[model samples]
Target chain A: MTRPSPKIGVYGFTGCAGDQLMILNCEDQLVDLFGATEIRSFVMAKSDNHEAELDVALVEGSISTEAQLKHLKDIRERSKVLIAIGTCACWGGPQAMKLGDGKFEERYKKVYGNAKITVSKAIEGQPLDAFVKVDMKIPGCPIDKQEFLKSVSKLVAGKHPYLLKSPVCLECKWKENKCLLLDGKFCAGPLTKGGCGAVCPSHNLPCVGCWGPTDDLNVSAEYDLLKEKGFVPEEIITKIRKFGGSGVMELVKNLEKKEAKK
Target chain B: MMILKMKKEDLPAFLESAKEWGELWGPTTKDGKTSYAKVDSLSQMDLKATRTVIPPKKFLYPPRFTMFDFDEEGFVERTGDVPKRILFGLHPCDVHGILIMDKLFLETYKDPYYAERREKTLLLGHSCIPDDKCMCFATNTDFVAEGFDLFFTDLKMFYLVWVGSSKGHDLVRMRADLFSRNLDKNDILNYTEYRKWKTAQFKAKIDLTGMPDIFELGYNSPIWDELGEKCLSCGQCSMVCPTCNCYNVVDEVDLGTAEGTRDRFWDSCMFREYSVVAGGHNFRDKRADRLRLWYTHKLQAFIGEFGKPACVGCGRCVATCPVDINVATVSTALKEQEVGK
Candidate 1:
């Protein structure tokens, strides 16, 4: 007997729908993806998206508004498994860089001014885990296309998708690219999670840490290396904070605490 | 082992004739970085290069490759298609690295992938000038005796070539006029002088004496933690090291299909995920623990098992590591109980 295809829903909240676009960009694999899985809801790809119970929910973007927070809860309630896709949904992306900085009000006012009544009140951007449980995370600025496809296939086959947790340096070395840090560049390859195939470094550009921090990130070491290379503390922090989001912020805070105790 | 001499000018003609054996590959410099690339003749190669960015192991065991293509029915081994190639300009330490690899991949369980590539490829060793990073003297691998088909030693006016195997002799026979077996007293004196000059040129003083004992004594030392903190865990040292041969395998399924190809890629013990197993139990979860395992394996465990350290002292780690955490630094730190800059 043939197994029934998993019912999947793809959703976007506040950030650019780049992850969903990445899925669409898999033009060669799209036909097979459509044929194998019952894509019950993919608003970006199809119009007739039903908000029904789903076996898996591929969620992209951060919960920035009250409506999105509510929508995320509803999505979690309707889905058996919710995998956060993209840096935005995984760690609040660049939008949540200043999270807990206590300057959101001033920044919001500066950007949006005094707008009248809105459909949903704007709130501080947060990852899906802030409201509901996130079963897994497929991280990138826009989620990597091959990783997205692999994750979907693994989930469909009733297997856990394995994500590479190593830093970008591994892939950089595999590509045989010269280390930018060795050349006195402020490369984030050693601190950021890989799986982008070391794309930036392969092209002679430094990694921007867009895939977020690796689990075993050596923040202080990276900071020290950059500092030794003549990068100011402020410049290093800004570079790390660009896509590091809440995960790296927590690590940095913990590092500071450890250092203080020392 | 037939020792012959060829004039420096006739070397290019000999190399041109040697191409009949396979695709000639040698160290070629690009953008100030040297790596092995296909070359037409000796003139296209940077024979003076100290070391290639990636070692000769890449030709035998590639960074990544498909092992098998499988559907729902069965797995079809993706063997064959390995082209016959000649790898030229391998330094003595690199040839020693290949010998260690032979003991690992060509013996015991025997990896067919590495075996197939090894069978097809021929190693052509070349003499090298000792740079500041060269530590092969400490490892006693500065002059290789085996593991290469041919070895060429530059004696300024002429090249003293050692025909290591029958294949090398065949290549020499192809260009018989370019080579001469006649050797005078001056050739021996010149070779001795060259060895003396090479020995004095080593600037990196890496002594691996009693490494196993030192590693055992310093098992729980705080130095591991200190080095771990500094280590990026980038695995660049492993990638560039001539003797590092760790690999990881994965089955990549095609989208929406059960069919896929099983692929093998270079893996490093430095990676946090390397020691992770089922049910989320990471054996070497701490970077310190991982760092200790890598060094212990290279300097201690491999010594116990193979009677020699896994590190060939090619100085790839010295050149590659960004934060100064290499065999030289780590071993020195263990021995001296102090980390060096």
Candidate 2:
């Protein structure tokens, strides 16, 4: 017998709320999703959101604080499936830049400057999976609607989410845009995942590696491409480390040593 | 392939014939720039402009269209009967832009909204004599010339009208008084010669050969950091492009009520927030990366699949960029980069 509709909950943390807004922006599909499932919670859209057991909990934003970490633990307890929605939850978002800024208190004091940070405290940002096992990640700064819907439908039907294994380069190919990289304009599509349907490229612009690094992406090859384009080691290396940070820094250390050997 | 002649003065009767179907929209003055607007008087149409500041895609895929509205009862599609109209005075680049849209809306997932609008409207393409920035010829997309219903090639005092569709032929029949006797071979030759001269008038050109190879090498290129520093993330390049079609959908609800209207608005990759998903995986987490993505997708990799550059080379990006970062300049820079030694 088909079980009753799975209860789904959507939450947002301290990002631009673009991701949650995007889900609500899926107005047509939102109607169908509501009818198809028991929406246990959605704070951004609806007032009546539950903090109880959920089939799926799509958390957006980074757990940047002790309180947020506790809440993430609770969400993991109640959620059978934890789906990280935006960049913050997936790859620590833009705020992840603070990882290199040393301690949070120093920067926090600098930003707040003797003024009380009476709100929740924060630490360096990290992806949600660092705290709790993320069942699936629908990556985008704000997830693409069509792709999001497909993932949601699949999950609700008790199926594994279909990840976009293709690189941003593939989708850019589909959009038929000019290659900014080819024009000596540095772009990072070659190593980024495809999900945004190559939106940036279609607009006569470049991909910024927003979907984060994909498994199987030829990062070394892309590095070589950027190097050949006459990009400085400082610039290209900085671009690569924006998301991966320490991981990339470590990778670069190895590369530098390898190059030194040559 | 029939060529007919019409005096520049008889443009009124032709527009009047267009009104019999739906609204007649052409390039008109708006916000100190030429934009495609609904027009009645022929005097309001700016036929002399290079291209409209706003794209013709607005007519087909409007930025703020309500795809649907929702309340407790159910969801209701906001479908209005499409009004047949004549979209006239489009430059070659804009015309090419619309054809790309036709491919997008019709050939792909089949957007009913655009298809409905397309079925109702008649496209009238006006050949561009081209200005200093035109590079459609360099991209080899000056014209396959298939998208428009009617094509008008201006030959001095007279207009060479090429009936591109049955609708165009019907339009001519309906407005018979506007035309003189059918044109001979000389008009076609003269128009072709004029087009060739117009292509040559462009001040910039880039050899787009092996762009993928060049781009494949440039992935680690340092040029992005230098150029990205100039990108203010203001999204002006996207806002002005004839073919930049990225968008974000939003829901506008009243304070007291949950009911709302959903609207699709144009969005740009340049926005810091464009890629920030709910859980926060900013794949392109850096300005440099976003900048790189914009250029590579346009000239290098998009060609790997689409068989043509996504850019129509309307130079709207050049015209509108606040920083004056020109693609022509960038492409020339790419040409300068040599492969690995």
lDDT tens per residue, model 1, B82-201: 888999899999999999999999899899999999988988898999899888888889899998999999989999999999988888899999999899999999999999999999
| Tens digit per residue, CA lDDT, model 2, B1-341 | 66678987787878787788678888876544577778887789888777665678777877447777876466787767667888998777887887767766788589877788888888888877677777777777676467778888778888878778898888898988887676678876877888778767777656666777877888888767756655545454665666677877755442223355566766667555577787978877677788778888788767877787778888777665434555666666656752212
For residues A76-188, what per-residue lDDT tens digits would candidate 1 score against the true structure? 99999999999999988989887767888899899888877468888988888888999999999888999899888877766677778888988888777888999998899
Report the first chain's TM-score for all candidates: 0.95, 0.89
TM-score of 2: 0.57
C-alpha lDDT score of every prediction, in listed order: 0.88, 0.71
Residue-by-residue lDDT tens digits, candidate 2, A57-153:
9899877788889888998999888898877778776667545545777777778787766777777777788778998887787788877877776
* Candidate 2, lDDT over the whole model: 0.71
- Candidate RMSDs in Å, in order, are 1.7, 10.2
CAPRI-style class, candidate 1: medium
Poorest lDDT segment (10 consecutive residues) of candidate 2 chain B = B251-260
For residue A4, model 2's alpha carbon misses the true position, in angstroms, by 25
